[model samples]
Every structure is written in C-alpha cells, then in structure tokens.
Target: MRRLMSNNLILSLFSLKMFEIFGCIWRYIAFVSNQNTFLLLTILKNDFITKNFNYKISIKT
Candidate 1:
C-alpha cells in the first residue's frame, strides 16, 4: 500500500509536470477555447495533495 501510494505520487507529479508544460505551450488555446488545461491541472494538484496527505497520515500512525 505504501509503495503504491508513492508510485501514485510520482505519477501524479509527472502528469502534473506534463500538463504544466502543455499548458504553457497551449495557453492561448486555453484562453480562447476552453479551460480544460487548468481544470486538469487542478485535478492533478488535488490528487497530489491527497496522496501526500495520506502518506503523511500513514507515517504519523
């Protein structure tokens, strides 16, 4: 479970970075067409936060 959580954290961070890069590259599209990039970014941010929070909680216990 701990290893799985750590892997999830890594995947989340990797995905977040990818989205951030894509966000930078397609910022104009995001501004003009849709807010998908930001939405995905926020989702990833929440995922990372939750995973990190769980990791901390497990460590404490």
Candidate 2:
C-alpha cells in the first residue's frame, strides 16, 4: 500500500543519514591519530638530535 511504501522510504533515508554521520566520525578519528603519530615522531627526533649535540660538546671540552 501507499502508507507502507512511504514508511519504507523514510526508514531508508534515516539509515542513510546515520551511515554518513558514522563515516565522518571514523575519518576524523583516523586523521587525529595520524597527526598525533607525526607529532610524537617529531618530538623524538628533536630529542635525539639535542642529546647528540650535547654529547659532542662535552667530549670536546
């Protein structure tokens, strides 16, 4: 019947919207994790460089 078809249409639309929202959330999480990893790597690299520089200076003195 007409009422049944309309109900089905509304249900499908609602499901589609929910799916889109979840997809966006997933992508955001992935992006944030990647950014955090990059930051951690940068900090570790700088620390290593600084330590090496200090060690060399100490050796020279």
Candidate 3:
C-alpha cells in the first residue's frame, strides 16, 4: 500500500539521521581521548626530565 511505503520511508530517514548523530559523537570521543593521551605523555616527559636534572645536581654536589 502507499501508506505502508510512506511509513517505511520515514523510518529509514529517521534511522539515517540517528546513524549520522552517532558517528559524530563517536568521532568527538575519539578526538578527546587522543588529546588526553597526548597531555598525559607530555606531563610524564616533563616529570622525567625534572627528576633527571635533580639527580644530576645531587651528584655534582
């Protein structure tokens, strides 16, 4: 029937919109996690450098 076909069309459109929204959210989460990991790596590197510098100073003294 025509009505059944129209209903199916609407449902497909709705599902497509939902899929698009989910894709955007997934990409955003991935981007934020990557930024967090980069920040953590930088913090660790700085800590290591400071510790090494302190160790060298103590050895010299």
Best by TM-score: 3
Estimate candidate 1's alpha-carbon lDDT, on a 0 to 1 scale.
0.68
Candidate 2's residue-wise lDDT over 1-61, tens digit each? 7886686667657756755665566566657788776566556655755765675466446
Task: For each candidate in turn, give its C-alpha RMSD to the true structure in angstroms.
Answer: 6.3, 24.9, 24.5
User: Candidate 3 local accuracy as lDDT?
Assistant: 0.63
Candidate 2 backbone collisions, by pair: none
Query: Which scores better on TM-score, 1 or 3?
Result: 3
Best by lDDT: 1
lDDT of 3 by residue, 1-61 (tens): 7886686667657756765665566566657788776566556655755765675466446
Cα lDDT listed for each candidate: 0.68, 0.63, 0.63
Residue ranges of candidate 2 with Cα displaced over 4 Å: 34-61
Residue 48 lDDT in model 2? 55
Across 1-61, the per-residue lDDT of candidate 1 in tens digits comes to 9997797778668867865775565565557666777677667666766776686577557
Ranking by TM-score: 3, 2, 1
Clash pairs (backbone) in predicted model 1: none
